[model samples]
Target: MLLSIRPSLFAILLPLLLSRHLPTAASRPAPPSDTWRSSDRFMDAERGTHVAGLSDLKRYFSRFGYLPEPDPDANPTDAFDDRLETAVSLYQTRLGLRVTGKLDAATLAEITTPRCGVPDNATLAPSRAHSVGRFAFFPGEPRWARSGPIVLTYAVSPTATIHYLPRGTVEAVFDLAFARWAQAIPVQFTKTANYESADVKIGFYSGDHGDGEPFDGVLGVLAHAFSPESGRLHLDAAETWAVDFRRERSAVAVDLESVATHEIGHVLGLAHSAVKNSVMYPSLSPRTKKADLRADDVEGVQALYGSNPDFSFSSLIESDTTDSGSAAARRGGGVRSSCMGFLLVLVLVIVI
Candidate 1:
């Protein structure tokens, strides 16, 4: 049966589905590029030097799961305290940067880059918790529990702001994105003209769209997707989205296919990867295209959905022995487990 819940119901269930993911920094307007320039005074403090805004930067780092909650009773200072240094070092390490506690230019550049709207860490789960390979799962490991062969339907909103690319172009980008995943995994995604009835709903919305997570204009966050059965994927309509890098270079356009590929990973129950080269990596630079999936990406999806019959694991990389089983059995078992866990909550909602 096709699941066609109303958007309002989606909003109600949204928190439950996304309870573990942290909020992106979209609420605050992203600063201009100069704010993070190499010569900027943002990190004027020398290594082992005390500087102003350490407290503020500590709070920001905490938001991204780099640092723990600041000590409430501790006195605030401009000094680059040991706690702040530790946090900075951790952040650098996680991003695969030079592991200097100091706020160096490269670190500054990474911190300032535009990224997917999903938070770098889950609020409820610690970073790198319960992960398989480099790819992680959404808070509670929500995934489509298919017990049999199925074609998951997706629909692109006709109302999408297709200023940068025409509707047909955008549709092809999504088709390519879905095809890329299907080539590796057993699942197939088909594009449908029916918006409401589609299993996966894709659209672009600006600012407060009533889904709690609002898009900030321009270079902060490009897009975000809900995990599993929720089937909600949203792109920030404000970005200059592009499919062709050469022609759209003047606009420094964000590649629609790249973002779609990453967002679709989320739709398939894969969270952001800490591996920088992986498509699931949270950040992507302007005018950059990362449509190709890395080895880590392949291993991640295959872990969840199992590999496609024609896709050979030995041909790519000899790591884990492939588990030949029904994709539906793996997915169906997971879905049943998840439903049984949430059955009480469902009953409570219905009774009230």
Candidate 2:
């Protein structure tokens, strides 16, 4: 049976069909790096209980610096021993979760969430404690040591690039991400064409691309950056990185700007923040965007690099409120428009 469709109806139907078939993050199978997802099987597990896959959970703890790396030669045991319990307690404490020393649902959920590749507690010193405040720094409190006005050059890797997003789009996102930090601190970031010589080098990489810390495909580890003068920022190319949530309607699509901003914080020497609202916070959920720096982030950065003369907490708060309100309005309008279009398409389909 052949049904004739008018040009107007065809236009609407064609877009819907194309969109439906478009490859999305949700459509893609879970990446191998998501092995932590299996940690849920050990939910509510405490010390003295031996679960089959508890060794994998121990690897997760070791990966994030909660527990020391196990000996490669020795076989890893699945026992939920005292060491594992202590590691779980430390992890919870670092993330501001309840320090129960058990694999509670909340702890498991956090374990499974996508987070930065950088260790939460990297070479911790006795003086620098996570309990001190929401913000933290690398062991030595690394900062770009410059006498005069701190100006750092950053460049994206020409060779290691993502095919999905345009080079210009990626560059612009990083530019804005750098600008956000500039607004808060005295440091100025300048984009450079010289990838090798640039103070900060950014790249999109797949599994095991040097730097010791390999990219764990997809949501496991979205990105990681080095502290201070190290000047390295790498994003996992396997991730469904999205610049706009509206256009890229993937269930697991991660906001590129948000990740970029957070990694830039690492490059600036701020470690994972306990404050969930701060960009430096370790875990970021899929389909969620948070680029703006909160008070904790600002204070942390300012401590390292003195505040920008024009910057003020009140001004930032006002700007954030205005931006949030506008974004909410846009989302509301988009929903209404989409509903109207869907209803119109339904009516046309019925008539045809």
Candidate 3:
């Protein structure tokens, strides 16, 4: 049956439904040797630190969304060295890194390479592929479905392993990621990690690392993940990953938590959503936050999972669109229907 509905609104209900893997943060060339030497005092930019001189450094990074502590550094940048005490204090607050401001293992990785970015997921080569048959989303919702899970017997790739952090913390991040997805849609799924089993495995990697994609340098790329196939996800070893937030910014803004959240969405069987209000939108609008999920993100996922027969008026959030753009294109005739939704107000996530 041929059918189509405005996924923008649907995104609110099932945030992961037909989501898009968005391209975020423009690729940047290697930074000059003196990236650390320059400093304008992050104080004016935002109220990140209470200290006037050094504490401001930590506050600045916090505002930028880099975890408070990063990996320790070996060769501290000259500017940071000049402000050594202050830099070290700032370093300790953010990343668990050495706090020396010199590039260490984790700190060097983040400084010389990107810690987080979008993933270059594999394409579902349509020309020659086997269909597992058809599974339909609930009636009136064609864009969502629960793709039955498949377990990997192992060795799908000779060289494959999870990247970044201790197993426990990684698992925690992954678990929270799923919970966020559940908030968007009620797939109500569960997971268990088995480094020993063929089903799901978790660990670290580098650019062109495992998959075809390769990291260029510090800000060139972040990381990538695959669909929930074999429960596989790839992280760029180049990333200076830390539970603590810290960033290696280039031309554009890239947040670790934000990109991680998006990649996890892909692992849950969602594609890209065009609606700007949706977290599934490929590029993160500077206006959006690293932690908050959008209505479209929530709705798109709901499409995959069946909705409760018992409903509530609170589920609706009105889109602020008028008779314009794609909204008009889908309406073949003049037949008008003001979509029943909640008027979005006082929120960071956009809803269309």
Question: Candidate 3 at 295: error in angstroms?
Answer: 1.5
Least accurate 10 contiguous residues by lDDT in model 1: 43-52
Tens-digit lDDT track of model 1 for 113-220: 568877656333322434445576777767788779757999998875545467788889899999989989989899899999999998888767788877655555
lDDT of 3 by residue, 192-303 (tens): 4435554334334543445554543333345555555435555544333444422322223344455667766655555544343345544432212344455555554544
* TM value for model 2: 0.76
Q: Put down candidate 2 lDDT per residue, 252-332, tens digits, no spaces.
A: 578899999999999999998776667888987676778888877888888888889999899656654464454443331
Residue runs of model 3 more than 4 Å from their true location after superposition: 1-165, 189-191, 196-202, 228-230, 242-255, 284-289, 308-352
What local distance difference test score does each model get? 0.65, 0.72, 0.38
Better of 2 and 3 by lDDT: 2
Ranking by lDDT: 2, 1, 3
lDDT of 1: 0.65
TM-score top scorer: 2
What TM-score do all the candidates reach, one by one?
0.66, 0.76, 0.40
Candidate 1, TM-score vs. the true structure?
0.66
Query: Over all chains combined, what TM-score does candidate 3 have?
Result: 0.40
